[model samples]
Target: MSDSTAIFDTLKAAIAAEEPVALATVVEGPGTGAKLLLHIDQTAGSLGNPDLDRVVSRDIAGELAAGRTGVRHYGPNGEAREEAVSVFIESFAPPPQMIIFGAVDFTAALVRVAKVLGYRVTVCDARPVFATTQRFPGADVVAVKWPNDLLDEIGHSLGQRDAVCVLTHDNKFDVPAVTGALATGVGYIGVMGSRKTHDNRTVRLREAGVTDEQLAKLMSPIGLDIGARTPEETAVSICAEIIALRTGRDAPTLTAGVGPIHR
Candidate 1:
């Protein structure tokens, strides 16, 4: 197989196995199709020079941290000046997590939507009867415990790529859920409720020591203003809001505007 094809195969396998990997392709200049395959400890393929591979691999790891994919110019020896090569670094971060803190009907819909969005979803609830693997077959996990307890156990695993959705809508449950989620470094914390419920929960969250800056991390009144009436429609709204928040896009329905569907 060609070098580029071989490197791509390796990247595909690593992604399929959920292993962190990156592919650096020489998109411009000499050796246009030259490629490098890198993992945390090992390296495969090459960009011609040993020093260039080492330097580019290290830089690619940093790109992977932010889950970025883009092209960068470099000298033949990987120097900053003189664009002898242009490498496209594609990061394959570990799958992002979706921790849904409710086992209600909305939870099922959210789990389905999250899965469709490529999240490794977990369904959590304090009640064992409500939080069952059978009830949420689409979820990767179903935890029967208090939200704070779960966070205390796995909060460290959460990071910018992870999301925590508070759908319990009960002040007692949601307060702890929001508090626990905020304590983590999760990127998104969406709380499901009407405007009135969100207003009341704000007071409870403040009492629980969630600061204004921290509360700002929350997307209360949860989904976008899509006027959704069904659980499935609400799920679409919530997932769309998550995408918009991540991409910094103003949430607008496709039918309401004109643009390329994917850009």
Candidate 2:
């Protein structure tokens, strides 16, 4: 088989395992069909020139982060602003993760909503009976562990595509969950509660060493201002808020409103 075929086989295996990878192919330029495969820690193949491969590798990282695919223009020897080459960068990113820190009725509802949005949802709680797979059908994982302990194991892997939702209204559960989620690089951190509960959480989070900048990252009283009442409705509101935040839209979040969250 050719070098390109070998790279393509590796790419296929990586994608099959849901591992992150990117393939940059010279589609319109010198040495068309030249390929470069990028993984998190290393690279394989080459796009003809070492300089061109290096430039496209950097661009591949950004494209992989956003899970984007498209052609990028560059001059010969990888110079910018000149279209001497067109490399199509294809990113194969794993599904975004959504870890729900409570196994309540709302958690089940949220799991369904998150899965519908292509998130790999996990339901976690300290209570074994509540955090069973039977209770949270369709969840990718059901962990009966404290929020902090669970985060300790997997927090480092979380990136901009991941989300953490602290739906446990209880102080004992919410405090550690919010704190742990904040420590990660996850894109969205939402805590579910009423205005009063959010105020109480804010104080506790502050006492727990959560800084002002980190506090701003938490979407307390989570979800959009869609007048959600039932658990199902609330789940929809929360998922909607997640999408809006990811897209950088100006939707009114529950945290931004005063008084009651429900109509």
Candidate 3:
């Protein structure tokens, strides 16, 4: 088969397997229509020049990691801040992940809400009986394991598009879960509790070696100040908070308040 045909086939296979990949096409440049297929650990095809391919490949990797797609400009020889070449980098990333670290009532509601938002949900808890497929029917993964252990295994995979929610509300579970998640690149790390519980959890997280900078990343008493009392409503509030955080919007979060979650 031809080189283009081979690249197209590989791209198709990667997308079919739900793997992270990016296709960079020189949309407006000397080598228009020239394509480069970028994989996590490998690459195929090239946008005409070796230097151009190298630079675009590096960019494609970053875009894929962020689960983003867009156009970028570069000089013909891969020089930065130049616009000689316009490559359209299209990222084919798998669904973003949402790992809920509890099997509580809020966890079930969050699972359903996350599914609606197109997140690949995983319900994890140390108790096997609580973390069952039957309890979380829509979850892609139901893991009966310690929160820290689970994060240790898959934490590296978490990216800016993913989320980690700690809903255990117990210091024994929340401390380790928050500490583990703080080490990951996951964009959103939310913990559920009241203001008092949030203060206590914060102390424990600091004791567990979570730096103040990392502690700032945690959205304790997690969710928007939307008067969300029920689990389903709370799920919406949490997901909304995640969106607000990602977009850097000005939303009233539970962390911003001084008193109770609800009046």
Please list the C-alpha lDDT of all candidates, in the order they appear. 0.85, 0.91, 0.91
- Badly placed stretches (over 4 Å) of model 2 are 40-42, 45-68, 76-80, 207-213
Stretches of candidate 1 above 4 Å error?
1-13, 252-263
| Model 3 regions lying over 4 Å from their true place | 1-5, 28-34, 46-68, 73-85, 203-214
RMSD of each: 5.8, 2.6, 3.2
Q: Which prediction has more favorable lDDT, 1 or 3?
A: 3
User: What lDDT tens digits, residue by residue, belong to model 2 across residues 1-263?
Assistant: 38778898889899878899999999998989888999875789988899988898999999987889999999989999989999999999988999999999999999998999988988899999789999888899999999999999999989888999999999999999988888899999999888988888889888999999999998989999998888899999999998899899999999888888766
How large an RMSD does model 2 have?
2.6
Clashing pairs in 2: none
Q: Score residue 194 of candidate 3 by CA lDDT.
A: 88
lDDT of 2 at 122: 88
Candidate 1 positional error at 91, Å: 1.0
Candidate 3's TM-score reads 0.81
Find the number of clashing residue pairs for candidate 3: 0
Candidate 3 residue-wise lDDT, 125-219, digit = tens: 99998999999999999999999999999999998889999999999889888888888889999999988899888888878888888988889
Clashing pairs in 3: none
- Taking all chains together, each candidate's TM-score versus the true structure is 0.86, 0.86, 0.81
